[model samples]
Target: MLRYLFLTVTTLAIVGCSNEQPQALGTLEWDRINARAIASEAIVEIYAAEGDQLEKGQQILKLDTLLQQAKVAQLEANVSVAQWQLEKLRAGYRTERVTAAEAALNAATSDRVTKDRTYQRQLELRAKNLNSQNDVDSADNRYQSSVANEKKASEELHALRAGYRTEEIEQAQAQLTAADAALRYGKLLLSRYIVTAERAGRLDSLPFKLGDKPPTSAIISTLLAGDTPWARVYLPEPWLSQVAIGDEVSIKIDGRETTLNGRIRYIASQASFTPYYAMAEDNRARLSYIAEIDLLDSDAQTLPVGIPLQMVKP
Candidate 1:
């Protein structure tokens, strides 16, 4: 009876210890970054191959930029034209144009004086019966037309001397500004044809071959980004309260003899169905919360993703 009691007590104690430190099972993962095509352009050149390490701003591949370059050139020309127009408006009329307008006013004034003198002589002749009524009417019409022409010429000269209106200058300036903005946008769009790494990472894939044209927004490259892989584990519902973000834990890999250190970076707020790898006979029916633990050791950087690992409770 004494031996039976000792064996039973030992078995219970072992079971209690196992329940206190349940292992959370999961796979290693790295943050993935996908570079997408901005346009349906043929891949002309590839600077980096798959499995190569890339730094931020490093060229990965080049797409056909002929079309985009042409567009940018057109925009640049438009900007130049707009700039010239604005400058012309701001500078007002040229010296030669002002001189012509002044000359026109003077000629109109001289013609009006001649017409006035002719009309007065016709009126005096009609009053003395030397000229007919028709002659006086014709003379009056000529004089009035000349006066209108002179007034028009004077206004034209005045306008030339007054320079451009405030509204006209502002409109020209706005056109130039719009053209410049369009040019800047075109240049930016052109740069997108050359694929470059936005972050330092390992180039995991090149989805398109050289000379292949990809659809717009299609994935052109995939990168495994981050300095180290993180442990993506599922915590059993029962143990969810025991662990929290910022808590340090031990990471055990399948073939690695030494364990790695990790910190809990995130834990899902809701519970989910237990994944196959994390499901055990006792916890098969229980839901689990997804958690991500960032590997703290620099050596973990070399670890491949999707390798099964266990999170040992601290």
Candidate 2:
């Protein structure tokens, strides 16, 4: 009879120790969130409102892009001019230009020949005492000047017929490349004027209205990603040692018919008092560590933020 009583007592102790009931007390939260603007500009248009569901890369707001657009336009014109210059260099001199250069060279040569003959005649006349030494000297100077001019015109004509030099064409190509890069950079800057969602999520708020200028570091809106919903639960000092990261737990949400499964993603290293204003000092002093639980099911993401959740030992 005493053995039977001992067995009953042992069974009761085992059952009581094995079962740990969980209390419902946590709020749904977002682990992935988007906030703040990449740059500062006056708000021009608001494409999204509070509580609007948005897809990744969806346009959220537009900043005043008048100046940016104008800058892009100017860069585009510069690129066009650079391209035309490069093409002109590649095409070399036109047929008409070559012909004109050749004609100038011929004229210069004829002038030089005429001046040489006149100088020779002047020298012969001076030798015979028919002209003064000053006349011969003046004619010689004119002949020398014509010779220099003729050489210059000949070189110009040769250059025109030979086409542009390799170095000249390369320099023009470099200028065109620089212009293209500048245009691309200008367009990239202009794209920043339109704010888009970085990920799929629901927009929470827009702090500024249209025409309001916000600082670059200021948050324009807050977004909560529509993935696995995380729950922030407080574990009392007594339960702190029992919880750890990666431990699975059963979650029951208030007003929900089904329970969800989750894993412990984080546990605060330090304990703090629960922020309960209405509670007495003694109750608030009860230290609890904040533990974050990530819901495992994709369907559970539909749970709204701020909804209460309960954690149970599985």
Candidate 3:
């Protein structure tokens, strides 16, 4: 009992003497968007550069859109033409198409009547033995062929007067759909001429200026990271019991006192081996839980990335 009591007292004394204060740390940076791909037309304007501040949705560039404007007008005309054609089909084939078919049928019928009269005369001649059997057969075949031609021409007229068949209309409608999609795609390409600032931040590493051409998918610039700089600090076993998220703590920065509001964003469920960077005499053979904290900063521009920071706990 005496040995156990001594061990308990020593552990409590060690815990009571431990310090939980903010360690001076460096700043952090935010990730960047690699936006590229400008309009292939003439480069019109470039509005941003390195170290320049930007607001959300601010226009950053422009390109010549003369050809694209003309193309948009042309697409509109095509839409009108397609709609007119569809209307004509819906109203049935035009009178002119039907008229042409009727004319052809009349010609066929006239030819058939003439051939039939010739066949009748040839039959009479064969009966009287004045004509050969081959002559009568030839006349009969010509009359039959003329009759078939007349039937074909009549059927053609019927089809034309019936308007577009369902299948034909469907095909035309499909073509219209394809044309609409193409026009939309062309407009999208046209809009790519202008790029904008998506977030509010300082810019860095901007490469292009007015009239400079950049390649597709190139990283020309970055929004220098700021706003409540964050750090992933490791929590050792000694302070495990004393810490939780959202605990208010005081930190020292460049000899100035600063307070940070921390919330436990995440906690690892299981810990394996300790990382190499966390190795030391007191920290050796120990595993740690990571805590992400947002540090407060007054100047938006001064915070750089990858700064060491210490977290304080109440």
Give all TM-scores, in the order shown: 0.85, 0.68, 0.67
The ten-residue window of minimal lDDT in model 1 covers 277-286
- Which pairs in model 1 have colliding backbones? none
Backbone clash tally (model 3): 8
Question: Which sections of candidate 1 miss by over 4 Å?
Answer: 1-23, 272-276, 280-287
Quantify how close model 1 is to the true structure by its C-alpha RMSD in Å.
Answer: 6.0
Query: Candidate 1's error at 14, in angstroms?
Result: 23
Local distance difference test scores for all models: 0.91, 0.83, 0.68
Once fitted onto the true fold, the runs of candidate 3 whose alpha carbons sit more than 4 angstroms away are: 1-26, 30-34, 38-44, 49-53, 63-94, 224-229, 232-252, 266-291, 295-308
Model 3 lDDT per residue over 209-310, tens place? 666666655655566544555656666665667766665444433333554444555545555444555444344466666665555545513545555445
RMSD from true fold, candidate 2? 9.5
Alpha carbon lDDT of residue 173, candidate 2?
A: 90
Question: How far in Å is the alpha carbon of 120 misplaced in model 1?
Answer: 1.9
Q: Over the stretch 95-177, how does candidate 2's per-residue lDDT look in tens digits? A: 99999998999999999999999999999999999999999999999999999999999999989888899999899899989
How would the candidate models be sorted by TM-score, starting from the highest?
Answer: 1, 2, 3
Better of 2 and 3 by lDDT: 2
Q: Which ranges of candidate 2 are over 4 A from the true structure?
A: 1-27, 31-40, 94-96, 126-135, 163-165, 231-247, 250-260, 264-293, 306-314
